[model samples]
Target: MSLNSNLARKVEVEIPLQSPSNVPEQSTGMVHRSISKKSLATRVEKMLMGIIMAIAFTLIAVSISLEINIASTNRALQDTKVSILNTTTINSNLQQEVQELSRYDRIYRFANKQGLKMNEANVRNVVK
Candidate 1:
């Protein structure tokens, strides 16, 4: 047996590939699954957006109501302050009038005008 025999040389093996016409339809299931996943994701995103909008609207309503309440309370406080000041001013005026009316000299002049005579011996002092 000679080592230089051409017919006894080693041969390379080749694997055969399938052509487009011979290939099986395995991508149909994958396409259906991808479409379903996209639709499900879209629905979830829409639901989340609606929930966020609802929360924002609720917060806005609450803030508006709080502002109205604060405004009303401030108006009431201002009215109360004005009323207290007016009452104090009226009370001081009444006190001054009372003091003027209770003077002894003024009372004596009124008595003389009424033809009343003063008798010092019968004068009475009353204390309250």
Candidate 2:
């Protein structure tokens, strides 16, 4: 044989093999686990979230109540303004009637019709 064939023979390696039965067996079954409770941090976080939600809801409720009160107050204020305007109009009409009734000419005519004689010395002009 050639020198290359001798080198190829030296490079060949052999190893022993085992049967499948000789390998270790592993169990394939459902795993059993105990139920676990929530952690303290998780419970605390949930409690804080609940409190925040309650506060937010309370604020919303209060705001709604305030808005209702404000609307009612505004309506009341408008009604008061309308009433005042009506009263002012009535007062103006009454003042005009008083002025008309207090006129010297109308009073003089009524007095003459009533057969009342005017005494110039007894008449006094009052200044207000």
Candidate 3:
């Protein structure tokens, strides 16, 4: 009955309990909690996943580029083949015409037309 009213009305402060985990968590928003600790294994796993995806994407792009180059090369080769065939046909035709124009009868006829006479004594057999 002798105690002061101020002592009885003094406010007491209570501390909140700490979390069990070694790292602390932060409340970011009303619905989300942010982690303060990032494990090494988790970071490494994410890095490895990103590297693998980048490599895969690069390989796919390279493969697609190679396919396009191959198609272009194939088309160029086909065009060259056609040109070669055409040129070869023209060469063969020219050779055939030369053969036709070089016959003994044709030569003799042209020679006679130019007022040239063949002398049997001066004729020599040629060997190839």
Candidate 4:
């Protein structure tokens, strides 16, 4: 019925603040940081992928180096084989020449054709 009473009835009420001791205390050393499971999983997956890629790159480099070494060794072996074959051919030809010169008649004819005189004392017999 009075204006003051009507105004008080229409006003909204508010609660008073309680003492800080009524609320639970937060620990000093505790951290409240949070990461989503999806973000954590993505981070772990990215780390694993990076590790796998590094290992793969290292293996590929080693394999390429090994391949190069093998190719070089193979080339060296081929060159050695070629040198051996050439030496064998030269040895065979030298042996044939020595055999041809070992005949007494061939030696005498060759000395005569070259206008060289053979002395008896200059001839030596090789006993094998």
Q: Estimate each model's TM-score.
A: 0.66, 0.68, 0.65, 0.58
Q: How would you order the candidates by TM-score, starting with the best?
A: 2, 1, 3, 4
lDDT of 3 by residue, 1-128 (tens): 55654555656899988777856765566233223234556788899999999999999999999999999999999999999999999999999999999999999999999999999999999999
Name the top TM-score candidate: 2
How good is model 1 by TM-score? 0.66
* Candidate 2, poorest ten consecutive residues by summed lDDT: 29-38
| Model number with the top lDDT | 1
Q: Tell me the alpha-carbon RMSD of every candidate.
A: 10.8, 11.0, 12.3, 11.4
Cα lDDT tens digits, model 2, 48-84, are 9999999999999999999999999999999999999
How far residue 13's Cα lies from its native spot in candidate 4, in Å, is: 32
lDDT of 2: 0.86
Name the regions of candidate 2 deviating beyond 4 angstroms: 1-38
The clash count for each model shown is: 0, 0, 0, 0
Q: Output the worst ten-in-a-row residue range by lDDT, candidate 1.
A: 1-10
Q: How many clashes would you count in candidate 1?
A: 0
